[model samples]
Target: MTHAETAGAPAGDVATEQASHGKSSLPLLTLGAIGVVYGDIGTSPIYAFREAMAVRPGVAATETEVLGLLSLIVWALALTVAFKYVFFVTRADNNGEGGTLSLMALARKTFDKPPVWITALGVAGAAMFYGDAMITPAISVLSAVEGLELVAPNMSRWVVPITLVIILGVFFVQRFGTGKVGVVFGPITAVWFLVMGSIGLYHIVQNPFVLWALNPYHGIEFLATHANIAFVVMGAVFLAVTGAEALYVDLGHFGRKPIVLAWFGLVFPCLLLNYFGQGAFVLNVGPENVVSPFFEMHPDWALGPFVALATMATIIASQAVISGVFSLTQQAIALNLLPRMIVQHTSQDQRGQIYMPQINTIIMIMVLIMVVSFGSSTAISSAYGIAVSGIMVVTLALLLVVMRRNWKWPLGGVIAFGLLYLVIDGGFFAVNSAKIVQGGWVPVAVALFVSLLMVSWMTGRNRLAEKTRRDEVPLEFLVENLAKKKPTVVPGTAIFLTSDVEGAPTALLHSLKHYKVLHEQNVILTVRTSTSPRVPDDEKVTIDAYNNLFFRVVVTFGFMEEPNIPKALALARKLGWKFDIMSTSFFLSRRSLKLGQKSGPIRFWQDRLFIRLARNASDATEYFHIPTGRVVEIGTQLII
Candidate 1:
């Protein structure tokens, strides 16, 4: 079972307070949100408008079609992003953190016993996000770099090679951390948005007739009139709202007010103006100019500079998603959705700044493969919207549960609200699913593979825990037997780590069976992962007096936290445990698995995969930051 499956106490006031304390200036936070949270959507204008206009291969977009497409794009932004995410979904945060998994945690906390469907939805959403993660970097960078074809006609061939180099550089710099480089991300993105709005406004003045697209009738009319190609157009139209999920995912980084203000004050208006501007430009210029209208907006002198700016903006967009993937992986490990991997803290002051080599390398490889396979931005754009659309639909489904259960909305209102957004999000999902034949299968395959890996790990761990429980002696039994027959008492403390505090640790049992000695102070240390994002220091350690010589220690950490046994043990002192690192010995169990004789073909293959994953997982001592010299490992054999 996942840690979220077993956790009961809900973290509310403390988590919220921790999230809000020592707040940055509202303006600064707003700027940061614009830079990081809106990067993907901000860069959409570079390709979104061009893609929508180029739906018919040889035909130029007529004034009617331009207005219709623009209207569709406008309403999509207002409804899906502004209405659903900003105004409504942001309110359903889990103790000030928001995401698919965080929403899952919140919804699960609302009920006495969470339904199985909730976990399914959360896992599906997260898996789909990995699909988005891979495609966003490929498409965003390719679209931006493709502008080089406009800067110098002869430079077209270099786009792919240059893009690969830049991408590799971005991944290479990830180990060094983003603290210094991240400082300029907000200012640069801020300028990009302003440029977008300015260029868009200039075009709107040149072709004032394009403003007619703002009418909802145009959008509805376009959809009705273009029945045959509506599905394809809708998928392209969704490219406009690609990065909307970032607003909710990065909620914990910058609070709701900053994000909300950034959206209204800058990002939203700029995006609308840019999209409208692109529409107006397409109408003013003839069909010939539709191919690279964004670059065409600039004069020859500014074309190179504009391309450079767009490249930077695209890189920033890619950076945001990459960091988001890292964050999500940390949450997955803590929730027990995946096995433990090495997580390195990149910043001392910023807890969220972490680096996972395994994830980084894997994403780099996948992204590079995507870039090479698709070759061009327009080709890869065919694969972009499907995963994001799936995520949006899943988010709305999970939000329905949150509305009724957590928000306590009346049944009628909840149903009405859910049904409305469901149609909108579901429509996007349906249309995008049509792109699967045109290279969209890449993300679908990635999502399915990740989902299978996650489910396998969770299932295998649960079965392993069950087997361990059956094989091990109960903690009470061990304590009672030790009380009756005293063993040679060692001088110092021995802390045996275990998942089940009620049962004797395998390491502890082995020590008694082999060396035949017990420490003066025996601690049954159990590390628990909470459903919330960050646990307060005061609530980190909970101690129970099991007996005179033995005690139980449960160190509770939020999923976002990196576990450190020594630091948590230091916190134990505040709760009356005199924890001394030098004199303490940490004991851990190392399991060597053997396939079960009763397993069938499918079960046997899954067991094999799980065992390989277990073998590759980071050691408990390293993952928990236990001192190496003071640790002891006991080996044991187990059958799946």
Candidate 2:
């Protein structure tokens, strides 16, 4: 089905003009929001400087080398952040929502069964994002908290404790919701840029020649002078664009215009200045000073304040990534890429402030593991760039499909952007590939596991759905012969759970064959999980009368949400659905799979494992909150 039809948007308005005038202030709000959401990219200044300095192992931190490194930093931001993301990728948002999955959804709608290459690339991108999510908080927070050591040499030992405390505080406050705190996030992030710019400005003023690094020639010259060193520099340059993906992923939270404005108007200038400022500081103070060039940019009196500001900025940066992980999980669920988990909305009005206990716990544990394994920001940085860069390559490939199918951009334009982005992204990927032997495998390993789980869940679900469809009985025949003629007179409502939206529900069919009659009030329910994270509660459940004998109720959930059948039924009652929870019988159809030749090679093992695991699992009645005593289960065997 088309996005508009599925989403219930008006038909003619699907490709209407952008909502510009009515939402003018939205752009400004978006800019500030982008600053907060995109802070991870903005704050790379903390570690990017040190990593770049380490590229040339034996060379002294000379003015020329510093200037050359600064040049590369500026261009990296310009090419990757400005040219690629802000100018190009932002324009490819699917109904203003960005990210690989959204783009893929748009492609599927526009092209209808897009090429396998496109789908594969998109999935790879999504798989890699999981790896990026696991490591971002670790690197971002650790780098920020490590600044404390600049104030007191002995305080270096306190970095981990302080970082843990700050992280705990951040996650603890999630229940209060981000709406209240999100209002200030933009302004705080804005100030962060200002502080970063101001410090960079101070250093640049002391060493005015640093401005010469703006020339691309300096970067090329640096590479020519030290070819071997330049190869290693890719790893460092990769750090400069670490958070670039967030810009596109968060396009929905804020519009494209504001992000564009912020990137060009404020963020771009501040980042370039600070990077050059770091270079200037290093040039004057030398190699030893490179360890803490950012801190040393300020006076002795301001060191404490500098550390405080860095801490806050880092926390905000990490918070954005953690929240993003939640958002990604929600999207994955909506697209049927993962199983439904409990997704609690934290706010009454804001749908974005959602809590997923399963996802939250998993991320927290993975992040802690990353911190313990890597031990410092520098080591984590090695793993960080590789995952993000690989994902970008995947995103670019998908974007080409979007341009052709959705935007109808010329083949030439699509090809041009595709080739250019691939080159830049592919080169970075190759550079990061070198680090795989040096602790970079961590994120790749994480991505592989996530990909396996995602593939397994999707494959298993499809197999089960097919089995159920084949075994299902026709509703009209059952209602006429078995249910209508019988005088069994079953009491109360019977809620039969079925995976399909149409046809006779399997549980109801089974009930008729065994018990010979349907309940007085029967509800055939199908729960649909949407691709978006949150759906309006009022629109959560859809009800229709099926020949006065069966009520077809489909409960929809955002990927980031859980399905509480009991609570949904309660809400249904408020909407005039008549069913007593105490008296209603919840019937679920359980499928048992026998290994056979019908299933695909990739899914044979996965389907077998899921069948065994699902059989011993708690019945849907318990999982969905149906009263235990009123629940019934019917099993069916299928050859996969």
Candidate 3:
């Protein structure tokens, strides 16, 4: 069945089922949530405060300015992360999966036809994630290692080189998987948060006046009165909530309850205490202490050890985003937003633990370039917020649709909610936009390139599918003709993989034209990606026998799943097809595409790029997990 055929069942049921499954293991899930979901946002304190203080580069930050900035950061976290994501956006998940793409999938189901705008938003959001993936490690590790300057001034020059080394090490270990070290990520991060809170609490006691920043009025007054400096300061202040988006993005791994419980119970309070503590310590000592306020608060004896802890926290943060990008790439490929790449599952027990060498290498190169070019955490901070801000805005837009359609919220309520958050998200995006000349252009440029690449792939794939459907013979016709004038029947079953289930596959056509024989049993197999995140095993395969000679089979895998054709095909036995894997041959068409004489829907350059992408796509046999010994590839040349 197609998506439309399967849409009869309620969508939220899967999410509810997924939620219930995590209830028995709530404590463990919450711990894992704290480790993975909060890792990125958890490390914000290292440089967020210092960057906010540097709004006026040479001048010492005044008490009002410090309080005001602290107020802005706290409110941003409260409204943006706490309220918008935890309380609301998570409600719009697609079959227990959350992310821009997941939300887009949910929203797309509301309409009879998939909306182009929703797709564009999803593509744009996913593209921006790559930018975030690259900058996250560079900025995070650079900020953490810069603490060496506080431990020993001479080590300041080693910050960039050391950052590069740490990043290299992080990517190198990815192939081995994080499952082994993942056990400690939670306890370590929890300890890190507690220590941050403890240090903050100690300073807040010394200078209770800093607590005044907790009031929202200070944040509002600062924005209203300091118009000249507020814009630049707003961009810097956003660093505090940079990793907040990860909460919604990783919603599928750990369910909603555990994530919410972990946040409200521990992560949220610890962050507030630490931020307030930094504020108090800066006010008590002097604004000059703001140079490295996170490290400054630590006792001389603990600075080295604390710096090491911070480095660990940052590496975990980096790992979280890197894993996230790999997941995003998988989702994109399943949806056909990008070309296929190698996805290696590193752990048998954990379905989500995956490593993509191409994505890892690409991110490593980009991160090293940014670290070498920016040279400091403070410098690279300019590029940090743009992609995140853009993603927030996209997620918010998609959420409005989900509210109006999926949740059955009134149009008025949806509008009111959208307007409220739009201003907040729009304000951050607007402020971050000002940093383009100051290195923000890097992510923006990367996003544009990636978006174009996605658009090219989607457009070209659609065109090719249309052309193939037009040119191919209908399966019904083929079955009728074969029955009338039978060719020599071969001994075993032959499964021809195709994009269109209704049509005879290209590989089957080529084999018959050259060899003049049909297999004793022929199967027309179509693998589909469902809108939901995961399909149940029982519903994975549907077998439709057109005649004894040909069977039309549709194997549906959810977007978040890795497709294993052999395993899925084994399910056909339940439908009365005598399955024998060793005797079956899986036939695939390998298309060698070239530029056509006349122009197509896409421009010449985009067409060429699309051809290039098609050529580099991962081998279908390996991607589909078909046994190499039983796979046969038929080459076909095509003009785009």
- Which runs in model 1 stand beyond 4 Å of their true positions? 1-21
As for TM-score, the candidate ahead, 2 or 3, is 3
Worst 10 residues of 2 by lDDT: 1-10
Residues 325-439 of candidate 3: C-alpha lDDT, one tens digit per residue: 9999999998889888999999997768999999889989999999999998888998889999999999999999888888899989999999998899999999999999999
**Once model 1 is optimally superposed onto the true structure by TM-score, how far is the C-alpha of residue 120 displaced, in angstroms?**
1.1
Off by over 4 Å in 3: 1-24, 57-60, 600-602
What is each predicted model's overall lDDT from 0 to 1? 0.87, 0.74, 0.88
lDDT of 3 at 313: 95
Off by over 4 Å in 2: 1-28, 31-35, 114-117, 476-495, 501-503, 520-523, 529-546, 551-586, 590-605, 608-640
Candidate 2 lDDT by residue in tens digits, 295-369: 777788988887788777877887788778777776766676665555567777554667666777777778888
lDDT of 1 at 490: 82
Q: List the residue pairs that clash in candidate 2.
A: 334-530
- Winning candidate number (TM-score): 1
Error of 3 at 51 (Å): 1.0
